[model samples]
Target: MDKKNIKKVVLAYSGGLDTSIIIPWLKENYNNCEVIAVAADVGQGSGELEGLEEKAKKTGASKLYIADLKKQFVEDYIWETLKADAVYENKYLLGTSFARPLIAKRLVEIAQAEGADAICHGCTGKGNDQVRFELSIKAFAPNMPIIAPWREWNIQSRDEEIDYAEAHNIPLKITRETNYSKDKNLWHLSHEGLDLEDPANEPQYNKPGFLELGVSPEQAPDKPTYVTIHFEKGVPVSLDGQKLCAVDLLSQLNKLGGENGVGLADIVENRLVGMKSRGVYETPGGTILYHAHNKLEEICLDKDTYHYKQGIGEKFAELVYDGKWFTPLREALSAFVDSTQGTVTGDVKLKLYKGNIIDAGVTSPYSLYDEEIATFSADDVYDQSDADGFINLFGLPLKVQALKKLKLGK
Candidate 1:
């Protein structure tokens, strides 16, 4: 809050209206201190980053640092969460929740490299991203000073933000009428605000810029489309027998999945800040990956390990959603998840039609299912007489309790 003490600050800039305004606001408030903008390119889109460097400087930033984090974002953050089966509240695949830490990490790196006195972010006080960004900054650099303009500044609403941008001559990708809050990456595209403010209102998916990834189920094709994905060590390696890079695989699936109305969820989730918020999330590629990965685990994991890992998945989701990615517990849970995935190598084929992910086929070399032992037909692998002694001991406690009650009947 002390402007005189702060000399130079590094900012996490997105070239959006909020961040664009913060650069000038920081300079005006902090005794005209220098502001270096750090923007992490986590595959939002090429359009979002096209003129970001020039825009940052034009908005009064000393310089712009664009960290190309697309590959790292998919491989390190997304894949790790997928392996743990970490889905927040059984629906959200944690699209934005996992992205903030990666962005904040680079912010800290730039701040440390530049030796700035403080770090700044454009996150509002109400959203979960503020927690995700600040907790990550603290985890990496505990002593780092974080300047959150939303929590400190006088600006209250998005309309006021647009007015401020207009008064300050800041160029934005959005305008007042068409403006809707969106966060895009290689994984998903999330949309909020507008008619979405009311839970009773139905989503206008046919509206322009409403569904970025794909069409709704009502608009999808009548014919079904099938996709086959191969995985090795629990991470998807290829699609339909074509080996592509992590980014390309997701891109291919996003295209295919989007066409078939694969993934779209209208969720009003509980925010980390205590209030509930509604958003329409489009995660085409992630939905396919989740199904493929979970099906592979079905044949690969034992009953005990498979059942136990389900609970671990819930806890893992909480840790990541709460922005505890850098904690030791996440690392330790990842170890357990990785250990269970040793035999999780296989292919999962599914039919995508009208928002249905129907199973087409599943195969694995390391499968534990034995047809001879499991079949009800005549087989030498499982002896019928062997279960007689096993059943006696298993039901001994129940049988003893019944006999004791019979003898002591009132």
Candidate 2:
């Protein structure tokens, strides 16, 4: 916790507004200690990654550790969250929320590996990421110090940060003209700030600082686009019947979903920090995957399990939003999710048309939906007499209450 005694620091750097100047700030405040920046390559795209190594060093980092974690990210964090059907506030795919834990985990690992005294992150005091990063680091290295510049520094606003960067000659990838704070990854792209700060203002997606990954619904194709997604054990395995890796599969879906103007969400959500923030999110591939996966679960999962898992999904979303992914309860919940996903193997055909995903068909070998038993036409599998006893047993308490009311002669 003592800055003077700190000899080295590891920072979660994304070359964004908060982090671009953190390397220099850490070096200056922490007794001119060596600052090592670790950037997670959670598929934010090649442009963000291209010049990062040089950028970190130029900005005063002793070195930059670029952890190529796209596959591990999708396989580990994204898939598990998806399998649980976890979406924050019924809309947010939790793209940024889920990625924070993974990044923080890597930061701790690198900090310990480098024998650093403290781990640092660039999350603002107003944001949830401060809790997400700090909690994750504490979970692993309880005693290691955490340096949060946004909470401690004199540089308060974005303008102040820009002034600091310019004074220090930090080559920022962004400019003051670029007002919106953006977070992009393989899963989704999120836009905050700009005119979006006003909840009443309709988000102009075609405008700068809004649209990034996909086109607006109005700009999407006139005709419908069909996508056939294949899943094995609840995870998507292929697109249009061709087997692709997790990253590629999601990427492919992004293109398809984007072309159809799907996965654009404008939401004002409850922040883990207590304040509500409005954000526009582009989760193209993730939208298709969620819809397709839910369709698969409709047939694959039994009615009881299907309905019960919705509550679990809400809890899972809460846990993720609260940055409690490393907790025991999360692991146990994940185990429960895995148990319910055994029969969730299926192919879901979807029609993506103008921001709408219409179901085409769903098929699975493990489907619990028995067409013969469910059909309106009479089948030998069902007996009309069975419902008499079933309803009697089910309504016995209500019937008893009714008899008691009648006997009371009210």
Stretches of candidate 1 above 4 Å error?
407-410
Mind giving the per-residue lDDT tens digits that candidate 1 earns over 326-394? 999999999999999999999999999988799998999999988898998998888899899999999
Indicate the TM-score of model 2.
0.97
Task: Tell me how far the alpha carbon of residue 342 in candidate 1 is from the true structure, in angstroms, after superposition.
Answer: 0.7
Error of 2 at 224 (Å): 0.9
lDDT of 1 at 252: 92
lDDT per residue, candidate 2, 150-186, as tens digits? 8898877887888988898887777777767889999
Go through the candidates in order and give the clash count of each: 0, 0
- Model 2 CA deviation exceeding 4 Å by range: none
Compare the candidates by TM-score and give the number of the best one.
Answer: 2
